[model samples]
Target: MPRGYGGTKGVRRPGVALALHFAFADLWHDRKLSVLGVILLAALLAPPVVLHTLQVGLVETWARDLAADLRNREVVIVGEHQVDADLLAALRAWPETGFAVPEPSFFVTTQTARLVGGRGSSVPLDMRTTSPGDPVLARADLPPPGQAGLILSARAAAELKADPGSEISILLQRTPTGGAVERREVILPVAGILPEAHWPGRTGFVSEGALLGFGDYLTFSSDTPDYRAPEDDERWQSLRIYAPEVSQAPALRDRLQNAGFETRLMTDQVDRILRLETGLRQLFGLVLSLSALAFVATTILIQWLSVLRKRRDFALMAVLGMSRRETATFPLVQGATMTAIAAALALGLAAAMGGSVEAMAQGYLAQPTEIVRPNLIPLLAGALGAVALGGLAGAVAVVRLGRLDVSRALRGD
Candidate 1:
């Protein structure tokens, strides 16, 4: 043995070694209670751990959906006055601009003929008419300019009971200025039906030439006997400006607005969704904080009661020349050991359950999703936090231990 190692004087110094020995002895003496403390701590920590993991999954899914929506949308600017072809050309020349197409969508009413055992129905339609160079139709595989046909959204097709190569009659209503409303019918061939995956709305597309034949070029048509040649409505009311990427949407929207048009960008919708996610996370965090406080209070009460019950034993230690400071170290060791073991078990449980919860969440979402586990960092933080809270209880016990009288304690006072 080394020179001073074998003596009680060497091993029982009033420092770490002596403190740890006393703490360990107390724990071994009441090992069942220590184990119970561990189990209780694990239960207390589980809620926040599980909630945090689920929050990650929710945020991830929302982000993916928002990004996809933004990527698929183009920044649109609607002007109070008509947007001229000159303005369209200027916008198309702008940096990061891909397509600057006039949006000639107007509200139209139509009635469908029942086909394939489907019932006839009257439906309101937002009809979009565009020129040759528009990029939107290119993504849908619509044939170039000369081919005249109507493209219907899945919902529109279902309501109309219409399909490609089927002919349908559209009732066009043109309310002339200071005259009775004029109604006309045009039979247009259905070109194709857009899959629901591509568009999630009831809409249809038509050629600008087809709409012009209905005298749709004028905002208001004339039916008076003394007829004036209708001025061409060559003015586009809105421009669908496509950006090179979704990231450029906000800046492009600003640029369009500065140049005198009201703009709506997909980024605005994405920002709102992000703000909502932040609020939800904050709410969950607040709940977790409350849960943590309850856990700490429970630990404090348990430790404080244990300390009071062991007063006689601590007094006996004091009678044997052990200092009050040495006696106080018992709770620190107990709290740390119990909380560490509990945190480890809780983390493992949370991780195991997190994967299953994420899979279920993904199944519910429109897109695939996976949650990010809080992992070792949060587990370590929880363990340390619990130890710190227990240490406060330990400090209270220490004060009581310091004030203890050996004689009174032995007499069961």
Candidate 2:
């Protein structure tokens, strides 16, 4: 037995004991190989994992409700003032018939004083106080009309520091049935705030009838005040659309185009997101392919060399009356044991680094507020699989040891 060794000759066979000693010593003596395996594995796997997780989360959490809104988001062109029954039916019967409702067109925006009541003061804060790129939220989340309700985006609620039952006064840009942009304020109790989305802009909402005379608020209008040039001629600049699915996008666009209705894809819609997701997946595949090549090369070369270096030691085991199986087990055991330790270290490092990556991506990629969780299935499977595979591959070198001419080898040594 060697000095300071935990076990002695009487406790275990010399070959197995020696194999165990070498196994634990691999990391301490071969530190570079340990680090290389972990680095290559993490690089190969992280990006796609993070992206897939976030996308899955958004679809499940936020998009479940938003799907209906986007499906019905489309533009309707009517030269005359009224929406006919046939036109309404035609829009609904479109191939991707997600949303068939007609949005009333026309509205007005004006600089009006709003009494955002926590203190109930009528001192108006002009549009300047609104968050940049502020859009009016749909206050329609209430339990249908005739219910007292007001709506605010999560950002607006924070800006106004408002809560349920708080009163808010909103003034539209104009009244319905055509005319000059006018001012009319309506007071309604704040029913709830919209769910927090990653978009930083602010939003506010009032009930469908909260602002009397604004029929366009419930629908769309050709005369929406393009806040950019309020005094300019109300040109045919903006439109709304209700596309059902991606397959219908081209046909629907064509339908509107043939009728001289100018249409555009609202990438704010998920189709744009789907394209972005495709790009990310391709990038992930590229990264993994590169890293995997490096990992395979490094692992095979280093391990194959390690086995060759231990040939002399293995010959000594064969000289000691060890069977062929015992001889082969020497390096297989050592490689498997080393892999176990490396996997543990890699997993810990990945867990720590994954959170930082999610935080960086949240705002950059418009990801959900939560971090993408690591895929435990692949991680575990890979960890176990790699160790088993390396152990098996290393056996080729060990098997050669059993055929060594022990007496001559020992004498030569």
Collision pairs in model 1: none
RMSD of each: 8.8, 9.7
Kindly report which residue stretches of model 1 are placed more than 4 angstroms away from their true locations once superposed: 1-15, 68-102, 106-234, 239-276, 375-379
lDDT of 2 by residue, 341-399 (tens): 55565666566666666565554543455544656897688678767755764575565
Model number with the top TM-score? 2
Candidate 1 lDDT over 1-413, as tens digits, reads 57874678545366555677878887787889888887887788777776766666656465655555534347765544476767777788988686665654343212222233336766666666655665556666765333356777788788888888776666656666788876655566777777775565666676655554544423454332121221353665565577765556666777888887787874465555566667768977887898788778777776677778888987787777777777778776766676667777777887788668777767756666444445577667776877777677677667767777888998998
Whole-model lDDT, model 2? 0.50
> Poorest 10 consecutive residues of model 2 by lDDT?
127-136
Candidate 1 weakest ten by summed lDDT: 222-231
